[model samples]
Target: MEEVFIAHGGCPHWGKMPTRDASYLREQYPHFGGFLAQRKAVDPDGILLYGHLREMLGL
Candidate 1:
């Protein structure tokens, strides 16, 4: 049987995932460019969570 996982807390609305907005970071804090780049590379798959119910109803 194949195994599945339900990972939580990485959603943008949850406010826990690292920011991918490079331009915003660059303008606000130039020193964090390297850190942000490293974070982006860590999650190559780029999976994001959204409300399925809300999306289905066009919320």
Candidate 2:
């Protein structure tokens, strides 16, 4: 289950169903900040961001 994965330091695939938030994912991914920066560059207006994705990216 999700708890078990979290207990073992499992990181969910960003493209799939991820229950963890950006704060938790930031710790798991080494280049999380860079990824965010890149995302911003690609979508400065966040036109593609909505719902869970917006919340997940903390935008």
Candidate 3:
């Protein structure tokens, strides 16, 4: 897989093709952070083992 870095509120051209913001990138950090944290818990041997950790931390 290849990753491309583009600045927010900016655009890049590819052979006369234009890529524009489609409201995919959210302005809130907590939303995306929560997503990753959820995925992390589903990980093997993750913090979900701890009962309190899952309830309080949502890890």
Candidate 1 local Cα displacement, residue 1, angstroms: 51
Q: What's the lDDT for all of these models?
A: 0.39, 0.83, 0.42
- The better candidate by lDDT, 1 or 2, is 2
Which has the better lDDT: candidate 1, or candidate 3?
3
RMSD vs true structure, all candidates: 13.6, 1.5, 13.0
lDDT (Cα, 0-100) at 57 in candidate 3: 32
Estimate, for each residue in 1-59, the C-alpha lDDT of model 2 and write its tens digit.
77888789776866776777889878888899999999999999989887888887777
- In the range 1-59, model 1's lDDT, one tens digit per residue, is 01121143232332333433444335545575575456458854534324552242122
By lDDT, the best candidate is 2
RMSD (CA, Å), candidate 2 to true, equals: 1.5
Clashing pairs in 2: none
Compared with the true structure, model 3 gives a TM-score of 0.26
What global local distance difference test value does model 1 have? 0.39
Report the lDDT tens digits of candidate 3 across residue range 1-59. 01243545343342333333223323423375666566586875664445543433334
Clashes of 3: 0
* Angstrom error at residue 20, model 2: 1.3
